[model samples]
Target: MPTQGWSELGGRLRAMREAAGVSLNAMAAKTHYSKPYLSQLERGIRAAGSDHVTAYSRALNVAADALSGPSQDPLRVAHEWLVADTPVALHREAGRRVGESLVDELERRVIELRLLDDTIGGGDLIPLVRRELADTAEVVKCGSYTEPVGRRLRIVVGELAQLVGWVASDAGNYLEAERTYLDGVSAAQEAGDSALAGQLLSSLAYQMSDVGNPADAALLAKSAVAGARTASPVVRTLLLERVAWANARSRDREATRRALDAVDDAYEERSPGIAEPHWVYWMSRDEIDVMAGRCLIEMGDPVSAAPLLTAAIDGYDADHAREVALYQTWLAESYARAGELDAARGVIERARSAAADVNSVRLIRRVEAIRRLVS
Candidate 1:
């Protein structure tokens, strides 16, 4: 114990325990370790017994080595969690009658969290949303539930995973987002939920399109359309919109125009009052218009994009701090394209103000883009 400096290990243990929402007194009670000992252990002054390592791990609800080991790589931990097999007993025990009400509650929570993502940028919400994804996955993994309930829970998990992935993308965790999206896609397919899988694929395409992988974006977007071929009119239209944007990102003007026309036609067929997928509840004429404007701006047709971007900004809700900032940047770009430098400056300033309210990685990048334009 003296050979190892306890500071780092102690810090890790303390942080993990705190992150797990366990207090010293509660941990002491659960681990049957004294509170003073626990406190000193965290301060790197006291050496814990070998038995205490397992006890602490249990009390903290983590792997024993997470506390006992000197160098536990977080990525390794995540990989292990992802690829490790669930215990046979746990899987079988899950058949004991998971309630429908639990599934309903999780579904409601997913909807609320999606709204949170819309209102608040991912920078401030990634960790929280990741925790939500973990909790839902935990329920599916450990809860005793009937087959029907299990299926419903799996579907909810897929949706949450996709949402988490999107939040990660918004927060600039591109690799993490991709991994989360793949996990969600697998869960959705396992549950026979094509629509959710398609939405997630589209999200991946959207991320790729913005992050400078237009070729990959185009492929994924097309796959999303294919996957959701039987989805509602609104859903297909939204996927097609992504396809348009992807093509635009790649500077394929003709393909972009074709996809855009398809989007418009599908939009016209969308019935206003029918039940649509909850994942796309926020989509509307306004959202479509913004995407259209973004595609035009990317395709060097800012003249056509300017009015549409302005209209979206005018109608965008205040709670969407990041998108409001981002959209304004797009409008500013459009103005600059037409030699309206003064108008561009005015719009960029307003965008700067909105950007102050958001904590998004994407918003910051756009802010920089606007700055470069004016400079």
Candidate 2:
């Protein structure tokens, strides 16, 4: 049921259609909407999302924002689609053919936003990323795309959701993080991309590990490892590393050792020069070394952790402030254990300073832990 605002917006839409000198049937033909549906939409009996506006604008040779005119109240105009009444029994729209250029543009923007996450931290980029996700989700729902193209679009949406969840976690918004992670998992499954789904699950496992029971965390990691069995060896290796980390946190030394050994085997099995998941593009010897060191530290094996931590810190990019800060904590702890107070203090200071540039609660907590050691 369209309310007063929706009716006003509908009136504007009708005016636009009429000014274009197009019949309802012609508009329906151009926009790929049924004539009856267009009539209902124009008569304020139906509400439309952003994708509908985009399609209609394309048909009328007008801009999308221009189609959503200011005839409605500010709040209604801003979130008109959100106010749409959802049916109790859901029905998914069938996939149709969206333009490749449109998909390509979204893909490019996604990658750029991901890179921004790497340098800027999640706190600053969460709102922008969240808004982008909403916009892209509308495209996935309403744009006409073939089954194959629709699959690709779903993957894009999944990737966006994953990024949003990652950012949310970093910013300490645990609830939002979990919700987006679950949403991404559904999206990945819908796209029939098990590898992506497993990756997202692994991320969720890690997030849960922060505050949940070690057993629960370990189970989540194990599930991810099982689900990604057919994925690339690198992907499997990464997930296995998480398993080791979780087990170590639980103080299951035997389980941690087994997981670590499995990760080693997976790494050795990987073939060189093959393409990897874009999400894991940053994984390398340095990342593995860091995870291994982290697990060792968690298991109270600072003696064994020291060398690995040092190597990882040396090889890590200085520009990655959040990671540098985090890795430095374990490295500092190792030094403190070895009675190298001066060296530990020095590294901890550097880490703390680096962490200041980021807004991650996790890294900030690590920073505080190391500061106590320095004192």
Candidate 3:
């Protein structure tokens, strides 16, 4: 295998192991390798031979080939397949029309992947989601379809691009994430789904806020809301929340408060009769409260943020390690800011414990920031 291949393979292995909740010591035990040996492999200090790869596969409970195979450059493939071709590729394979069954299967797979993302780090999901994008792109380029079918296929492609962009962002590949999100925006526009295009833009804006581009994030988020005037109440609320976050990150308290108020108004306008997008399925009163609390945290009002965060986190699912750790870290930061050092340290321990089994670089960084604060 190429050196780059081994390095990428090492990252995948480490992700899978951590996602499986296996500690390095435990993995070494299972693989019958020394801790130092496994460490070297995971750090890419030493290339993994086939035997070493097999050991990692067995320890992580993944397919051996998944650990050893050459890594595909999904970003390159995406640009080639999605950007270089016509809106819908003209060249088609004979007798290979896109069908409802294929589309249905693809939709199901997308939902499955989204659900998996809730419980695992992006490192674990990046390769799987990228493969889905690549395969779907192939179908879109080669398979013949009616206009309606083609539109649906393009929507699915756009959804996968959003997911790929999300995982890429979580894995700290910001440039790849931005490029993929733009590709999805194009796909959504081509499908004539303004709501989906808005969603993609909002997702990118959220990422920008996280990566310290709050001005750009705020602009893109507001534009998303303006462009998708017909979006459902929930979708509108989600976009509004991103705007709040961006503004908060920019330290514009007035703008942040206004955006937060807009979120509440949009959410209250939600009607039972209106069909919400599947992507917004996780939105709830508590979710909104959490975002509001997070906004307050960003605006340096931990006193106001603490209670909202506490209540929301109190009812959160503990099994979601990354989310739990992230929320707890924020909560801990609130305590530290409020001069409740003991409380902050206590919460930091809980956050650290929650983060122990996860492999998210973002989560780790956030937790460490809080840890440093408390220490």
Point to the candidate with the largest lDDT. Answer: 3
Relative to the unseen true structure, what is the C-alpha lDDT of residue 38 in candidate 1, on a scale of 0 to 100?
A: 78
Model 2, CA-based lDDT = 0.76
Candidates ranked, most accurate by TM-score first: 3, 1, 2
Per-residue lDDT of 37-56 in model 1, one digit per residue for the tens?
77876875443333445567
Collision pairs in model 3: none
Better of 1 and 3 by TM-score: 3
Evaluate residue 233 in candidate 2 and report its C-alpha lDDT on the 0 to 100 scale: 81
Residue lDDT tens for model 3, 1-375:
212334456677788888889998999789877777677778854444444666777777788666656543433433343334332233332345677767766776576566556666777678777878877887777677788888988899899999999988877888888999999999899999889999999999999998858999999999999999999999999999999999998999999999999999999888634666667756777788888888888888989888988998897655466787888888898889989999999998998887777767778888899989989
User: Candidate 1: minimum summed lDDT over ten consecutive residues — where?
Assistant: 72-81
What TM-score, over all chains together, does every model reach?
0.73, 0.72, 0.74
Note each model's CA RMSD in angstroms: 16.9, 15.7, 14.2
- Those runs of model 3 whose alpha carbons end farther than 4 Å from true positions after fitting are 1-95
| Segments of candidate 1 deviating more than 4 angstroms | 1-97
